[model samples]
Target: MNSARCILSENDCKIFQTITDEWHNSINIEECFLTWESKSKCKAQSKTSFLHTLCFHIRGLGLRWGEVLLLTLNGKFDVITLLETGKFCKSTITNAFPDYNIFYQKGGNPHGGVLILIKQYIRVSRIQRDV
Candidate 1:
């Protein structure tokens, strides 16, 4: 059997080694997260009204534009539940990046954290077009 050799640059190799050496480091990461509720403000637009509160909460969490836009009523409810339980999902990077206004125009793979939100918008547009 032939084995394929993986090639990496010195810096890449160093990074790989660091991660491998610290594979158990994740346990310490949660504590490092900046709790969104604890922060006073972010640069994103703030809508203080009740209907807009959910959107504000998502933005406060540092969720990307796509993820925020994709959020639904149910998703917002889930966020509340998780907060009550002191459990939250780990965030991950996704392919799409939003413009400055925090709106997703189009194109990109959905990271796990952003998938449900993205699906919410896609479903709406599909329905609109079908009408």
Candidate 2:
């Protein structure tokens, strides 16, 4: 088991320790190289005049909102988009993120929904489309 332990820097260990139990269990440590690389990419992008966005296809957010919120807050993303929310009403989505401006389009199929969450500081306008 000792040999299987992941070798991480002190700071990386600290960051890893901060991950929520749900996320920790859901993600395998060995498969997370992309996550670390994305962090570096985000840092590099931040130095430039580029905008950062975090998008996820959760499949279902009914029982996994906590885990998703943990990642979103920790990532400090400018925008968050979620798919397959399994939410039929707008109130449910609004209640999840009171601080965010939520826009969603519910599909006719059960357990199918799309949501976009934008932070309060960012200005956004709703565009009406003729369907």
Return the lDDT, model 2, position 113: 84
lDDT per residue as tens, model 2, 2-109: 222368766666656655443566467654656667778999988886456878888778767777868876886768888887764577667766778988888666
Pairs in clash, predicted candidate 1: 70-117
Per-residue lDDT of 24-123 in model 1, one digit per residue for the tens?
A: 5545655324333233255233645332224232322343335554653234332111011111233322333221112232223232122222222222
Global local distance difference test of model 1: 0.33
Per-candidate TM equals 0.17, 0.54
RMSD of each: 19.8, 18.5
Query: Model 2 off-target regions past 4 Å?
Result: 1-47, 88-96
* Minimal lDDT window, size 10, model 1: 78-87
lDDT of the structure predicted as candidate 2: 0.73
Off by over 4 Å in 1: 1-5, 28-131
